[model samples]
Target: MAARPVSGAGAIRVGIGGWTFEPWRGTFYPDKWPHKRELEYASRQLTAIEVNGTYYSGFKPETFAGWAKVAPDDFVFALKASRFCTNRKVLADAGESIARFTGQGIVELGDKLGPILWQFMATKKFDAVDFAAFLKLLPASQDGVRLRHAVQVRHESFAVPEFVALCRDAGVAIVYAQSDDYPAIADISGDLVYARLETAVEDEPAGYSPVELDRWADAARVWAAGGQPDGLASVSDPAPVMPRDTFVFMISGAKVRNPAAAQALIARL
Candidate 1:
C-alpha cells in the first residue's frame, strides 16, 4: 500500500501521531500482528506519521535508516523536535540544542523525512524578537536533505497577527492545533500546512463523526489547492492561491480511535 498522490494540487497527507499504541492492537491492527511489525503495517495504512518519540530521545543513524526501509517510498515521517530546543526561557540561546537535535541522524530518513515540528510549552509567551531569532537558528537543510519546519505554539499569545507574520517571514508553518487548550491559528504562514486534529471522542468509532471527517477532507483539499478553509479561526487574510503540501494528523483526545479517524479522512480524500 503506497501513499496516494493527488493530481494538480499539493499532496494532502493524512495520518495518526505515531504507529505504536497498545489500544490500537485489535482495533487498528490485527489481533495476531507482531508488535515489531507495527510500523510496517501502519505505514501501509497511513500516508504519513508524526514521530513523537524523537521529541524525548535521540536515535542512531541505523535506527532511522531501518525505519526508512520499512515504510513505503511515498510515506513520510514528521518528527517532533526535541523539547530541549523549545522548552527554554531564552529561545534565542537554543542554537546548540537545535543543532544537536538536527544533527542526530535525522537526515538518514532522507526523502522520507517530512516536516520537523517544534512544539512550545503552554506556558511560553510570544516574544517577537526572541522568537524571530529562534526561527532564524533553524537550518535550511541537513546533509543535502532539505528540511521543513513547523511550530506548534500552545499559548494564546501566539494567536496574534504578529506571530503569523513572524512565521511567514521565517518560512515556517504554524501548526493549526484543534485542541481546546491550545490556540488554533488557521493562518497560512509557510509553504506547507500542518494540522493536529485533537477533538476526537471515544463514543465515535472513527474518533470524529462522518460529517466532521467530510469537513476535514474538504479543508485538506482547500489547503492543498492553496486556500484557507471558511470555518477555522484565522488572524490574517487567506494566503495566496498556490499549491501547498498539507499534513493532517489525528492526535490527542480519544487516542484509541485516531487511527480510524486518519484512515477515514484518507478514504474521504
Candidate 2:
C-alpha cells in the first residue's frame, strides 16, 4: 500500500511514449502474448510509460485503477492531457474542458501517476497573455494527489525568454522535445525535467547508436543532479545545484523500436 520508491535517492525514469502500438505486440511483447497482459509485461521491463490513450478519450476511474493494479509498485504512468483541453482555438476558453479532463478519473492512478503532458499543436504560436492564463488554469492538485505538469510546445515561437520565465514562475516544466521538425529547448524551468526523444532510426537495432544512448544516459544523470547537459540548445541558464527528477521517453521516429531504445537507455543508466 505504500508508494513505490520510483525516485528513491533522486528520481530518473526511462521509457517509451506509449504501450499500445500494434508493431510492439510481437517484438516487444511475446508473439502470443495475451492482449490483456501487455501492461504487465511492459511495466516490468520499463520503469515508466506515457499514456497517450487519454489524449483521445476519457477513461473510467476503474480503468485507471485497473492500470495501477497491473503494473509493478515501482512503475509510473504519465498521462497525456485530452485533446479537448489542449486542442482549442482559445486558450482562455479551455477552462471547463481542462476541468472536465482532469476530473475524469485521473486521480485514481494515485501514487502511480507521474506527470500530465499537455501537448500543443504545431500551429499554435506563443501568446504570452493567453498562454499565461492557460497555465494558471492547471490545478496544483486533483482529488488530493499533487500533480506535476509538463508542456510540450511544438512551434518555434515558444523559443523565447518570456515563455521560459512564465513556466519557471508557474513551476511547470516546458518539455524538452528532441525532433528535427520541432524546436529543441532544454530549459530547466522547474525542478523536474521531462524529455521526449524522436530521433530514433529503424536501421539501428537499438533505435539509437550506443554512442547516442550513452550520451543520453549521461545527460539524464546531469539533470538528476540539477545541472544542464552541455552542447544542448537552451533558452534559460543552467539549473542551480540541487537534486531533481528526470523523465525521458523514446518517442516517434522508429516507433516500432521504441521499447528497445528505452531498455537500452535504462541499461546504460
Candidate 3:
C-alpha cells in the first residue's frame, strides 16, 4: 500500500510509550498473540508508539512484522534499549547485546524505527567512571541518522547539573522526567528536548488520563511552535526531528497502564 499523506501539516506527531491494553487489560494472552484489536485501535488514534515490552528480549520477528504491517506508515516505534543495555541489574556486555537486539525488531523497523530509549535503573547511583565508560560505548554505533537516540536517567545523582551537561556535550539528550526522587536536567541546549510525563495526575503514576492528555497535547503544540536546533536550522525554514514535526511521548505508568495511557494519548493527539 502507498504511504498516506499526513494531514494538518503543523500538528505534532504524538506517541505512547508502548502497548495498548484496553481489550485485554487484566488478562492478556501469554502464549498466543496479544491484544490485536486494542493495538489496532491505538494505531488509528495515535501517530506512533514506543515498544516497551521488547526490553524483555526474545520478542519474535514475526510478531514485530505483524505489528508493522498493521500500523500506518507515518506511525513510529521508539523502543526501550533493553534491560541488558540500561539496567544495572544486567551487567552483561551491553555492546554486543545492543547489536543483537537492534538487529531484530529495532533496526528492522527500517524507517519505522524511532527513538532508542536508554532509561537507567532508578536505584543505580552515579559513578563517574562507569558513566563515562558507558558514554564512550554509545556514539560508536547506535543507529542510522534517521533514528533519534535518547537517554532517560532516573537517579538522584543523575539530577546533578554536571552529569546533565556531560550528556548534552556527548550529543545525547538528558530525558526530562516527572518524578519525586530526582530533579530534571535544566534545558541548556536546544539540540532536542525529550520530555516524558509518566502520569496524568501530577502527583500519581496512574498513566495518561484524559486530563493528562489535554495538558500533554498543549505541551506538544508549544513544542512544535517553538522549534529547537534540529527542529530549526539556519533560522529560516523550520522542521522537527522529522520534517515539519515535533516528537512528544506520553507513556503508561509502572502500574501497567502503558496500553491505556497510550490509548488516551492517541485520542488527544
lDDT of 1 at 99: 94
Per-residue lDDT of candidate 1, residues 1-269 (tens digit): 32234566788898998888999999999999999999999999999999999999989999999999999888999999999999999999999999999999999998899999999999999999999999999999988889999999989888898998889889999999999776798999789999999989999999999999999999998888888899899988677777889999999999999999999999988
TM-score-based ranking: 1, 2, 3
| Alpha-carbon lDDT, every model | 0.92, 0.87, 0.57
Q: Report the number of the highest-lDDT candidate.
A: 1
RMSD for all candidates, in order, please: 1.3, 2.5, 6.8
Model 3 off-target regions past 4 Å?
Answer: 1-11, 20-34, 89-93, 139-145, 180-182, 186-191, 201-215, 225-245, 253-269
Reference-based TM-score of each model: 0.97, 0.95, 0.69
**Clashes per model (N, Cα, C within 3 A):** 0, 0, 2
Candidates, ranked, lDDT? 1, 2, 3
Q: Which one is best on TM-score?
A: 1
Q: How many clashes (backbone atoms < 3 Å, residues ≥3 apart in a chain or on different chains) does model 2 have?
A: 0
